[model samples]
Target: MAPATQPLLRAALLLLLLLLATSHQATGAVVATELRCQCLKTVSRIDFQDIQSLKVTPPGPHCTKTEVIATLKNGQEVCLDPEAPLVRRIIQKILNNAKSS
Candidate 1:
């Protein structure tokens, strides 16, 4: 109703809309995976004794193949093929360990 305050109200509304748009863009953003598949290549077998730890990431949107990453005693990481017999046994061992604990 007041002409003098109309400009101020318009500016405040504009600022609110701008802030909302920026915040939404910052929070509701899709983070694209840098590496679609973490393992570009995999080894059929690796010495079981040398492995310090193992991590398995199941197939998902980022990668179509299951990934098995092994950390060696020397702090080195290697990818092992899931289809490999040795790798399967190692995975089974790890799963058994988790179940027992």
Candidate 2:
């Protein structure tokens, strides 16, 4: 190939590779988001015993559901449904523990 044409070809190849990489990363991000959404939707219960801390966020005007954010001993956070019976019990336990201390 001609020297002038070689530079242009190399540039075109590099651009193609960059586009492919960007597209792949975007697709991966979409898939990960979808999976996380599915997991959140399907989360009905959690082990309250492992929870180290809990934070309750009051419901907003648009929504009437309060969010209970539980931080586990391992530092992982999970959002719990406040209306759940088990979650209420867990919250009570935490409150009792605090009061006793």
Candidate 3:
């Protein structure tokens, strides 16, 4: 290969590699967004008092968020963040009731 041609080829290869990396990242973001959308379809607006069971799920490999799964009498489960103040209060209330019972 000619000396000047080699530099141009190297630059083109680097640009292609960078574009591939960026497209892969964008694809991952789209997948994540789609997953979240699918999960949301199972969730509805739930009142705190209607929660039949509030279970805490610790963060795992796939799900990094510590979630509180609230099951209602209608068999719908809504995911909430454990760190949220209102969720914490509801969890505490449930635990206290359990203890008294």
Best by TM-score: 1
Q: In candidate 3, what are the lDDT values of residues 1-101, reduced to their tens digit?
A: 88989989999999897555433121122111222221222222346767778767565764665656676666655666566677777878888988999
Residue 82 of model 1 has an lDDT of 85
TM-score-based ranking, best first? 1, 2, 3
Q: State how far residue 17 of model 1 sits from its true place (Å).
A: 41
What's the count of clashing pairs in each model shown?
0, 0, 0
Better of 1 and 2 by TM-score: 1
Kindly give the stretch of ten consecutive residues in candidate 2 with the minimal lDDT sum.
26-35
Model 1: ten consecutive residues of lowest lDDT: 24-33
> For model 3, which pairs clash?
none
lDDT of 1 by residue, 1-101 (tens): 89999999999999897555433111122222245766656788788899899888899998898987787787766777889999999989888989999
Ranking by lDDT: 1, 2, 3
Candidate 2 lDDT, tens digit per residue, 1-101?
Answer: 88889989999999897555433121122111221221132134777667788777676653455666666687756666677788888889888988999
Model 3 ranges off by over 4 Å: 1-46
For all predictions, the C-alpha RMSD in Å is: 13.4, 10.4, 11.1
Worst 10 residues of 3 by lDDT: 24-33
Which is the better candidate, 1 or 3, if ranked by TM-score?
A: 1
Query: Cα deviation in Å at residue 51, candidate 3?
Result: 1.0
